[model samples]
Target chain A: MKVPALVVQNLTKTYDNGFQALKGISLSVEQGDFFALLGPNGAGKSTTLGILSGLVQKTSGSAEVMGADVNADAFNARRYLGVVPQEFNFNQFEKVIDIVITQAGYFGMTQAEAAPRAEELLRALDLWEKRDQQSRLLSGGMKRRLMIARALIHGPKVLILDEPTAGVDIELRRSMWAFMKDLNAAGTTIILTTHYLEEAEQLCRNVAIINHGEIVQNTSVRGLLSQLNTETFILDLNESLDAAPLLNGYAVRLAGLDALEVDVTKGQSINDVFTQLTASNVQVRSMRTKSNRLEELFVSLVRGSAK
Target chain B: MSPARIQWVAFSTIVTKEIRRFMRIWQQTLLPPAITMTLYFVIFGQLIGSRIGEMDGVGYMAFIVPGLIMMSVITNAYANVSSSFFSNKFQRSVEEMMVAPIRPITILAGFVAGGVARGVGVGIIVTLLSLYFTHLQIHSLLVVITVILLSAILFSLGGFINAVYATKFDDISIIPTFVITPLTYLGGVFYSIGLLPEFWQAVSRFNPILYMVNTFRYGILGISDVNVWFSLGMLVFFIVLLGAFSLWLLRQGKGLRH
Candidate 1:
């Protein structure tokens, strides 16, 4: 019942070249929730993030961060939010610690406070050892981590990340995820956009998918996965089939040598397919799920909306 | 820290970063200009002046000193900010400040102040070098200081505008080469405007740099070529105009906006 940390109402944006980036997008994020925004390239995710952070002007619509109108009171609104841009954009000549501390200063923090906070955030992100190093000297992943630490320095209530681990390695990505989850558990509302579906599957309790500048889906993770009525399972048959075998009551196709691909829809049972195959004197080998209902649901929704 | 204090800290931090970038590569950013200015004094005052003799009741060397100093101030101030800002754009690092909570006006002031600092620094260096060739007679210390400071601020603002609109390295060089260089030369940096034909003298009144160099000359020599009040009035007007334009560009997110 507490007020959501962010409430975006019909947020729209159009560039001068007549490209519509956001088409009346509306959504809300509950306080302290870890929300994931999933989208393909050029799907308005960055534009939405820009509008929320007050960097990009909206053609129409309104957004409120912690009840502060982003358009009307940008400074107050921005004060409550922190943004980690996808691009590596800090001044290369600046040291890592300076980058983090300067971000704190923008919100009016003194050196006494910002220094310790910067150190803490940098150390927490495993950047303490690189504090004195110029940002230009840091590796790509290190620079990206520095940006994350910079965003957190002001102790903003809401944190927005745009493709935080786009090109990062798996190990670093997981560590970053763990750190973000910890922040969210500590009560910072985290909003992130990513192309990594499994990351959303594991870390986010709620997910929003945007396509062609419009919100296609906004719901709890479980709720969205539940929308799928069909799932695909791959069965490694004991023997290879020369042709597509008949498996009644379910769609079945040859996956590969010694494998059968089976798809089960709503109101149909895998037992029916198994019973028919057994009756036909077919021997069963090993079996495994090829695609989860959740993945199927997401793919169908995004791809369907694309068309 | 309180909010007001945080904003000031952010402002100073950006300015410091800008200063560091230019200083770190002093050879590339600072050295070339000093060398170029030194050559100008040598060739123009020594070589050319020997043939033209004295003008404006002062030695050929002294008559061109103020013009040369103003020339260095204008070019350095304009170059410092324009190149610095353009480099940020090329490297796409200006986004660091863009995403932060700092006000647009503070960002404008920070870069402009950085540009002014470098401009004044280079101006003084060039002036000290000038002392080797001629004595710098101070007609009005206050006027001399005021003219240098204002000119620095004005050109720095112009540089910021250049950086904002420049999309490439060529974009940065185009204005300095075609616009700024020609204006400084045509502004009477070497010879007095009285030598020009009447038609050309009438056309000279329109050049802004002429007003600037002439104003600096008036300060150093206590002599007037054009109305001193008109020059001072134009400098103030440009400051306001440039300030407002730079702020507007900042708010609009010019090249740094993204």
Candidate 2:
């Protein structure tokens, strides 16, 4: 049997001040898979990543990278793992290329070995022109890109990013998405944590939602969305409607002069709503879901699970 | 690669990065110590030695040169590790090493090596400057090399401890100001403990810097206030104790880990 890319079981962490950051969480990422670890603020996402990255010690249980135990055999474990932490952790005074090259050195690579790899990552990330500039001089987006270049220098089997695209512009975010997809396609397992649920919904096949220091939900993306009984879609009507158009067995409300909000249950066909609307003289200009499916499900799951 | 070879690479990488860090800021790390010791050579060695003439059967200028070089080495060694390690912690960049595959001893030794490099570098610069002011003689080259290396190693460990416990910039400077400086001054840098009265001299023997300065002084002039063998032994004992304590600190993740 092939080993998983990352295997974390019953991992727990309690800070010195007695805050239980992780309360025995367990999960795994398959090899060559793109996985999402999603959570609200302070929901053990970062803590889990921290433990896996070797920055924090677990109180009990185990975490492994490509079958190498993080505690008993950290050298090999870390050699197979790469991490991009949530914060900007590199020295700001260091040059951009030096940061990536230094990271490669940490993995026991010499300058000669690291330089060519560094150039590859820098060029792929579009940071080649900014190589010699001090990291402090780069803009926020470029700084984040520099970190990405650093993370990939060693080409580990598993790459974990803690909100890698936070605060990045849309164009950069899309480009990063493309880069990540390419990496995933090239046989590297990816584990990502992010606030943007659409990124998860669009990119990940498998996901785990953490809440209150525990894995509240773990399943495929399709499986999680299948649990929602209904989806709310907003219809953009070509003309103003004084009241909601009557559609039998559907909860429709007039949200504005030009829009109507309707709840479409799992069994109902969207074409039925369109057919009913045309008959009622409500010409539909356009339609889209009221919000991201994953976002809504995540909010409802977290709020419902809250004590 | 073999595991041993892997460790060597990681260790050398850390040392190289640390050396590059200090060299990149030579104005702060190298120049200041050289200039300060030169000032000491001129003011204390020339201006005052002219009036005082010889002490311990040698020119007062020659008497203080080794002490001044040792003093510069101690301060620079301590300052280099303390500032570099603390800055890494302040910026949280130390995570890079903490998360790496390297052993804790590699980190400890690498930082100490960097400290020693700066310390010895400053010492040599001071020694060369001393040649311009007066004639120099080497009484015992082996003792000079051994004691200088030991002294730098011991204080580099001291700086590592300070950086581990330091929570702020002021904390890094506090021990140096209150403990190290007082010890170095009373360690008989400018004047011999032989002149400190019989009772005070006994008290001076307890100061570690006293042993280092006197042993280093004996290396240069073949004259010292304490037994050179006993002083060298004390230096080794302190290095072992501190090196073990520093290794324990890295294991505990004090101030470095959450």
Candidate 3:
């Protein structure tokens, strides 16, 4: 759709000493997509982001952002993208307003244009109150938010966040997610790389899981979670069942001192399990279902890809 | 509007910000060199000069003024860029510039230009300070201007390289201490090489900084211990080499991309 917001084709990066960081990664992000790139530590996620942003040099292959080749037309490619790096990169000695405005200046914005945009972004990010404060004086959450504001100052079509909520608290994290979702809805494409699976599951409609410099899975959120059909049900019984009985073909395990966990797969109804429990003369105190569609899919994908 | 205009805007922003950063910290950037040079004038020019007398048909005070001024220019220009670039690297704020739509050459030019501003600014301040101690004269105004500008450009390139290679706060101190310090001291800032034996004079010629100071000295007093053309040639040579080297480092993303 519209040439996709970004196109990364066979992107490869190998550091000196032959340490390959990205091994021919090929992916595309559609326009207005809330895309999440998920991976464990050292899973080539940063390498991929770095190359896409024109920070890290790619060893081979090509990438394009907004129809502009990242390596060949880096300046033009970058005009459509903004990046929030993982580390604190702003000058601590600079005032918050100056940091954002200077970032705008790098894009050739005059002071008249950059100043108002900087203030607007700062206000939107809730940094207006501390606009004049030195960057060193900002708290961790404030600093992270400042980075978001800075990235948006240029009014880019695509925004990349590299671990935007790595050390932030739950409230700020949720609010930041809301802000990102609103931005995406308003037509700014978001490409996020995060260690937080829950955030990915909640906010991202599309997900890409990278492991060991390769994409293990790239699918729609619903499509990925639908792969997990089984639900883990816990039953607390009033009386202890005798003989440590083995159920007929049902996968079961002891969850706690008085609870039994039954993993029910597709084609097996919950009613059948209840009927079978009644026949065994086991008195059920309470029953609860643990819906782990995302977790289950995540674990299986990571484990299977590791092999 | 045009690409040239955009590039100039970016370059101006970088240079302006650098000037502002240093000017804001005037106590550290401007005051220290002035005080140091004042001490050198008092101790070396007056205290020692009265005892040693003049060596090259000029007052020892005026003799050392151009050298001191050049020393300040070289060091400040070098310091301004090296510290600024390294600080950006250490803080990771360089990412802001890196992620933007600016060209690599634009970034290099912005930084080198910033260094040049600070270097020339501090040189002017030190030159004025030298006036109070000695009567300054200009033998060749063109040489004086050319040497100052060329010297600043060369050192700015060296500073950018240093910043590219520096990883930590402590890492930045290595080159300035072990390399820059020795070069400046041995560059004939304090004494002319004519006073030294023939072997020492040959060794002094190997220093790139000697050419810069002697070139400026020749500009100021119409006297020199070395060939002016030779000094000019070396200055141009290092400028090209260091300029190419700095640009290559930027292209390679050396120590900057990690």
On TM-score, the candidate that comes out on top is 2
**Cα RMSD to native, each candidate?**
3.2, 1.2, 3.4
For residues B1-258, what per-residue lDDT tens digits would candidate 2 score against the true structure?
566766777778777888899899999988888888888889988998889888788899998898888999998899999999999999888888877788889889989998999899989989999999988888899999999999999999999999999999999999889999999889999888878889999999889898888889898899998899998888899999999999999988889876
In terms of DockQ, which candidate is stronger, 1 or 3? 3
Given candidate 1, what's the lDDT at residue B238?
Answer: 97
Q: Residue pairs in steric clash, candidate 1?
A: A108-B6, A108-B7, A109-B6
**Candidate 2 chain A, run of 10 with poorest lDDT:** A101-110
Report the CAPRI category for model 1: medium
**Which candidate wins on lDDT?**
2
Better of 2 and 3 by DockQ: 2
lDDT of 1 by residue, A21-66 (tens): 9999999999999999888789999999998886788999999999
Q: How many clashes in each structure?
A: 3, 0, 2
Give the Å error, residue B73, model 1: 0.8
Rank the candidate models, highest lDDT first.
Answer: 2, 3, 1
Residue runs of model 3 more than 4 Å from their true location after superposition: A233-292
Candidate 3 residue-wise lDDT, A6-90, digit = tens: 8889988998878988889999999899999988888899999999887898999889899999888887888899899888889
Model 3 residue A292 CA deviation (Å) reads 4.7
Deviation of model 3 at A192, angstroms: 1.0
